[model samples]
Structures are given as structure tokens and as C-alpha cells.
Target: MPLSEHEQRMLEQMERALYAEDPKFATALEGSGLRTYTRRRVYQAVAGIVVGIALLMTGVIVPNVLWVSVVGFLVMLGCTLLAVTGWRKAPKPGEQPVSGSAGGSAHGRNRQRRSMMNRIEERWQRRRDEQGH
Candidate 1:
């Protein structure tokens, strides 16, 4: 269920309090926004497309060198795919929860830490198995 306006305000106030008390921890708890493709990603994709277009023009000017443009276009396409699909993959299951240390309820903090540790251990075990160590 969505938080009511009052609850949202309260949460915001709590976040501010946490930020005031400890900026480092608060910033970490703020977590990334839900949407994908940050401004940098979008800018990079735009730059890639522009470069590809430039390469295409260069290829057209030089006879029998269409591969330059083709490669550029492919790279541009790959960047576009990375900007779109690559950004949306959710955090793996049982990842850490976002809760400011000072603001989180006791049970919430415990659960979050436990989940985070479990994920770390699972990843470590996977690496060990893969390396035959």
C-alpha cells in the first residue's frame, strides 16, 4: 500500500533528521531512484549517436569504406540497448534494503542487515565454486 500524505511527510522529516545527523549514512540510505538511464547515460547515448553520424558522413565521403559507418552504427545501437535494457535489471533477490541507520525501526534494520549479509555470502560461495577453490 502507498503511504498516506502524513506518513510520507513523516518519513521525509525522518530522512532530513538522519541527513542532519550523519550525511554519509543518510546519502547511502537515499539509494538510487527507481527509474533507469541516469542523465549521464542519456548524454553518453546521445554522444554516441552523434559520433556515429559523423562517422557515417565520413564513410560516405570516402568511397568503398562503408564499413566504418556500419561499425559506428552498430556501436551506437549497442549503447542505446545498454541505456535502455541494461539499466532496468533489478537488484538481485535478497539484496540490502534502503533504510537510514538512525531512522529505521529495530526490526527493519535487523532484517535489512541479515538480508544484505545473506546476499554477500551467497555471492562469495558462488565465486568460490566457480574458481574450484
Candidate 2:
């Protein structure tokens, strides 16, 4: 959902205050560099895999060029590894739901769902109170 004007203004004010207090820390929190690096790495890996496929096909078509296919296979393997590692290392954005102490069991999920529902109910109640007032 989009932020209300008042909420947006408050958020902007808080952001300005944060910037004034600690510009470097706020900038570091942006995290664009890590995202960009991960994207670039994945793209490069995909390109490498495509090139490897072409090489493999070429080697197979040509007689007595087994080395090309072997090299292509190795390249594909390396690129696959690179892509997997890059994706794994990338940080997930947004708030993650807290799991219960018992790990991610059905009970944990139920609790989380109930908490979210309670929050929604509280918000609805507050809105009703405000409208009534």
C-alpha cells in the first residue's frame, strides 16, 4: 500500500534527520552496490553459459575436437557455480518473519499468522476510533 501524505512527510523528516546525524551510515544502508555486483555477476555467468553451450555444440559437430567439448563443459560448470554462489550471497531485502524457538514448525507459522491478524485488527480498531472521534 502507498503511504499516506502525513506518513510520507513524517518518513521524509525522519530520513532528513538520519542523514544529518550520520550521512555515511545512511548511504551504506542503501546497499545498491552489493545488488548491482550480484546482478552483474549473474549476467556474466549466464553469458558464459551460453558461450559454453555454443562451444560444446561446435566441438560435437567437428570431428576429433573432443577438447573443445571438454573445455565447454568445464566452463558451463564454473559459470553455474558462479551464478549459484552469487545468488546465495545476495542479501534478501525487506522484513523477514521471525520464526519460533522450535524452528519453522506449523505452530510457528500459526503464531506468526495470528500476530499479523492481531496487528490488522488493532489498526482497524484505531481507524474506527479515529472516525468516530
Cα-based RMSD of the predictions, in order?
12.6, 10.4
| TM-score, every prediction | 0.42, 0.50
Candidate 2: where are CA atoms >4 Å away?
1-14, 88-133
Query: Considering every candidate listed, which one attains the maximal lDDT?
Result: 2
TM-score, model 1 to reference? 0.42
lDDT of 1 by residue, 2-100 (tens): 999999999999988988999877765544542232555677778888887888788888999999888878877877886685344322323343335
Q: For residue 115, give model 1's deviation from the true position in Å.
A: 12
